[model samples]
Target: MYIVGLSCYFHDASACVIRDGDIIAAAQEERFSRIKHDPKFPEKALTYCLQESKITLKEVDQIVFYDRLDQKRYRILDTYTSFAPLGKTMLWNAIRKWCGPSNPENDLYHSINTLSKKDGKIFYPHEIEFVDHHFSHAASAFFPSPYMESAILTIDGVGEYATTSYGQGKDNHVTLERQINFPNSLGLLYSAFTAYLGFRVNSGEYKVMGLAPYGSPTFQDRITEHIISWNPDGTYRLNSEYFNFFATEQITSSKFHKLFGGPPRKRESKITPKECDIAASIQAVTEEAILRLATYVREATNQKNLCLAGGVALNCVANSKLLRKKTFDHIWVQPAAGDAGGALGAALGFYYHYQKNERKISMNPYDSMKGCALGPSFSNEEIEIFLRKQGYPFERLSDRELFSKVSDLLVHEKVIGWFSGRMEFGPRALGHRSIIADPRSKKMQSLLNLKIKYRESFRPFAPSVLAERAGDYFELRTDSPYMLFVAQVASKHRIPVTEEAQKAQGIDAVKLQRSTIPAVTHVDYSARIQTVHKDTNSRYYHLIKTFEEKTDCAVLINTSFNVRGEPIVCTIQDAYRCFMRTEMDVFVLENYLLRKENQPVLFEDET
Candidate 1:
């Protein structure tokens, strides 16, 4: 049976298709729409999934939406009614307008209905089902995890009425034991702090994480004393009065500013030591909360393994802390742990819960995701056809030759746009769609960000190392196939470059250095690593291996294949458009390669 899952309305709108228990294709709508964090109906993504699976609406046995609209409506009503004496009619009306029939959720139903109407002659009605948002998040993490039975935890911004949930999954059955409702959300608490720190709430949380390491935790006691009452049992209640997410137009009210002793900082403004310290303090609190929650889940469920999902699960730093705590013997976090993964989870939940399918655990960590390469892919023939139609110069090489050439280019310090196999399903580029540079080149990080990425200079690039050699370069022992862990660079390899040398040199000088690759290395001398195993992604492994053979370094710089503020490339056109717009030296789409000089100037002006 075919199951189509969808998550929309909220940010990171996406679609996932599954045949039986195996995922066929999954992608975020932002990639195709060229909008960052697009919260639309994901029509392009759904269309791509259907095309990639060679199926139609008639073939799909079930359509599962990630959340129940009625459940969400209930929460809105309940909250508003509770505050009726305080007068919240305006907020209620605004919410009603937002959830009108023309909104994203209604549009999704309309699209499916339209498609089903055309296929009505062949299929039956009432095929669509709505899964609980938190349940979908739980399933997305637990179902694909390499565990027969595991404790499940899902935490995110308010979903329906739940903000956090704890459950246990054994075989095909999942039992939700407890849930923390809205107005008492850890996610919202963090988002409030994120806003107060002068960052975009949902999107800029990572910046806070990155900045945390730079300061001391001076405000930990203050936060625990005034803002939240964290419990030792891993459950906590927000003070609520200082937060305005529920009642006010802003995330933080004037009372919050008074409690915190200042107004929210302005974005792109100078970062003060106080801001850094606050970031550190909040991050520490968040990590402690996750650890406590994991411990409670483990004790309550008596499960040795754990599965994690939700927007908060995307915090790699918190994940590292959880791993270090060893609360659960093994932990598997969904790659797309945010709302996008909700789509995949919805499908899996529908299969196991509604369809009564038995859950199967494939314990091989290498096979947990089929490399998460479940997005669009173009064959060499298709790429060649596109290049010819665009009148671009290109070459088609055999697998061996292609690897050798790309390896040679990397050794020469030429940044290459590598688009091969299917696109990755999550927010990361796991070799399929990536910008590859020589990790040894100290200037590579700056060059790519300034010329190609056009983003902040402080952001660090990641390293894609051969799986077997990952330990040799990074102080990490576990497999990081998804680039989810930040591991320190081995001390023996971190030679300090002088301030003068750092200031005077460019890519050329950095390339000749026998010391630190300062560009990719963070201030902590660590890199977020993606380990590539030949069995998981043979082509990508071979390409890295080829580079290794030439430079004797088993690692290469790998960043998402997109410019700043854009989603990673999903289609051939997306890749080509990105390649043409950037200052990248080469474009390697499948087995075909194109040079910058031979391509048309796709961007009107090179800003």
Candidate 2:
């Protein structure tokens, strides 16, 4: 049976298709729309999934939306009514909600109607059902995890009324034991700090995490003492007076600014020591809270494994700490551990909850993500056709020859866009849709970022290493196929550089000649690594192996295939468009290779 899952009307709208218990395709609307964090219904993504799976809407046995709109609306109304004689800000928010195009019921009905129109010849009414938001997140986390039974946790900004949930999952069944309601959320607390620290809330949490390493946690006491109170039971309440999420138009109020001893930092401004300290303090606090929650869940469920999902679960630093704590023998985090993953969760939940199908526990030691290559892919014939039609000169090589050529290019310090197989489902670019270069190239990181990504300089690139050899490079023992963990680089590989080299070298300088593989290593001598296994992603593994044979190094710099503020490429056309827009030296789509010099001048005017 075919199941269609969807999450929309919130940021990172997405779709997923599941057949039996296996995922067929999953994608976020932002990828197709070229909009970062697009919140519209994922019509394009759904269309791609159906086309990729060769199925029509009518052929889908069930349609599941990631969250129940009625439940969410009820919570909103309840929260707003309780604050009656509502201030102007609250009144405006209510008005917008009641009449907004983003209203939950309106969006649901509109999405259904729009899909029906597109599938007019094939669709029938009453085909879609709504799943609870937190349940969807829980299912997404547990169903694909490598455990037969595990305790489940989902935490996000807000899903319907639940911002956080604790549950237990065994095989096909999942049961929720507790949940934290709206207006009192760890996600909001973090997001409030994100806003205060001059980053966009919801989207800027990662920035905060990245900046935390630069500062001391001097403000931790102030945060825990005046801003929020934590309970011994792993539940906490915020001092609402300092927060503006419920009653005010802003995320941070005047009191919050006053308490922080400054106004909100302006975007694009220089990062100060104060900002770093605040980021470090909040990050430390957030990790502590998550650890306490995980401990509580472990004791409550008596489960040896834990499955994590939701936006907060995407905090790789916290996840790394949790793994180190050993609260659970094993921990699995959904790759798309955000709202996008909710689409997949809803589908899995529908399969088990509504259909009552028995689930099979298959861990797939590499990870159940199937490399998360769940988006569209093109055949060599299609790519050649596009190249021919566009009058672009290209070469078609055998698989062995193609790998050899790309490997040689990497050895020469050339940056190549490696577009092969299916696009990834999450924010991460897992080899299939990646920009690759020799990790040993001193100039590669800066070259790729300044000329290609066009983003902040301090951001670091990741290393994709051979799975069997990962332990030799990183301080990690298990397979990190999803690139979710941040571990220290093995000390043996550290590079020694003079203080003058560091001072003269900007964030980009850290990219050049600090180590044997200077491009991918961070200033801290660590790399966020993705281990590639042949069985899980044969093509990517072969490419990396070929590179290793050519250079005697088993690692390469890998970053998402997109520019700043854009979603990762999804379609072959999107990949081509990005390749043409960037300074990448070559584009490898399947067995076809196209050179930048031979292509039309599509990006001549782009900054």
Candidate 3:
């Protein structure tokens, strides 16, 4: 039986198809729409899933949505009523958008109906299941994980009425035991600080995490004292006086700005020491809270393994801190831990819970995520045809030749756009859709940021290290295939900085080389790692291994293959456009390679 899962009408809208409990395909709407964080119904993504799985919409046995519209509507009405008068305008806007004739439920049904029509035949779904938002998250984390049973934790911005939830998953069953409701969310709290620090809310939270290590936690005390009320049971409530999330579109209130010593920083404004300190303070607080929560989850569930899903689960720094504490013997985080993974969870939840299927775990590859390489892929013939049609210069090479050529380019400090196999399913690029470079270069970090990415100079890149050699370069305890865990550079690979460099604060500190792989190392001597496993992605593993053979270093700088303000490249055309737009030296589409010098000038450049 085929099951179709969908999450839409919120950021990172996505779709997935599963056959007999195995994921066939998954992708985000932003990838095909070419719009960052597209929230509309994922028609294109759903279509791609159907095509990739060689099935039509009629073949799908069940269609499950990530959240129940009734629950979300109730939550919205309740919150707006509670904050009445203060949120009158916002409440009206919400009511008009969600409760009007064209509500989410209606739109969703219409979209499904429209997409199902083919050759004058119409077939509606046999069953439509709407799950609790956080339950979807928990199922996504636990069902795809390698554990037979595990404690589950899901934390994110408001999902219906829930903001945070914890439960246990055993076999094919999951039970959410307790939850922290909306209006007091850690995700929203972090997003408020993200906005205050001059970044987009949901998308820019990681930017805040990247900036934290530049400064001391000078404002940590103030934040803990005035913004959040702590509890002994590992739950906390946000102080409403400093937040405007309940009543207005704005995340922070005037009182919050007053406490922070200023108004929100304008986008693209210069980074000040204050912003850096605020980032550090909030990061510290978040890590502490997460550690406490993990402790509580462990004690309550008494489970040896833990599965995590939610936007906050993407914070590598906090994840690393939790790993160090070892509150659980093992932890498995969904690659697409945010709402995108909700689609996958919705399908799996219904399949296991309603259908009563027995659970099966894949031990050889650690988990059933298949390295999160579940997106669309292209053949060499298709790539060649496009290249020829576009009149772009290119050359085809064998696997050995390609790996050797790419490795040599990296050693020579040439940045290469690597596109191979399926695109990654999550926000992370992994290796399939990555911009790869030599991690050893001291100037590479600044070069890639300013010249290639065209973004903040201090944002650190992650390293794709051979799984076996991961411990040789970084102090990691387990595999981090999705680049979701930050670990320190091994002591042997770390270099001492000058006292003057040590004294420098904020962005200036980025100039210091802290490790042998300086380009991927952050100011705190940490690196977000993606351990390349040969079984899951032999080609990527071989590329890194070949580089290691030549340079005696097993790590390669791996970052999403798009510049600032764009989703990662999806199609070959998207890859080509980004290659021409950026200063990357080489572009690899499958076995074909195109050098920057050989390519024609961009269309804009021609005009």
Candidate with more favorable, higher lDDT: 1 or 2: 2
Which ranking of candidates, highest lDDT first? Answer: 3, 2, 1
- RMSD in order of candidates: 3.7, 2.7, 1.5
Model 2 bad stretches (over 4 Å): 82-90, 93-102, 117-127, 496-514, 603-607
Candidate 2 lands at a TM-score of 0.94
Tens digit per residue, CA lDDT, model 1, 314-433: 888788778777787777789999999999999988898777797776655554578889988888888888878877789999999999999998888899999999899988899999
For this target, which candidate reaches the highest lDDT against the unseen true structure? 3
- List per-prediction Cα lDDT, in the order shown: 0.83, 0.84, 0.92
| Per-candidate clashes, comma-separated | 0, 1, 0
Q: Write the per-residue lDDT of candidate 2 for residues 52-142, one digit (tens) a residue.
A: 8898776788889898777777776787777655456676766688776867667666776676666664333366788889999999998
For candidate 3, the clash count comes to 0
Model 3, 512-605: lDDT tens digits are 9898899999999999999999999889999999999999999999999999999999999889899999999999999999999999988953
* Superior by lDDT: candidate 2 or candidate 3: 3
Worst 10 residues of 3 by lDDT: 118-127
What TM-scores do the predictions have?
0.92, 0.94, 0.98
- The TM-score of predicted model 3 comes to 0.98
Error of 3 at 471 (Å): 0.7
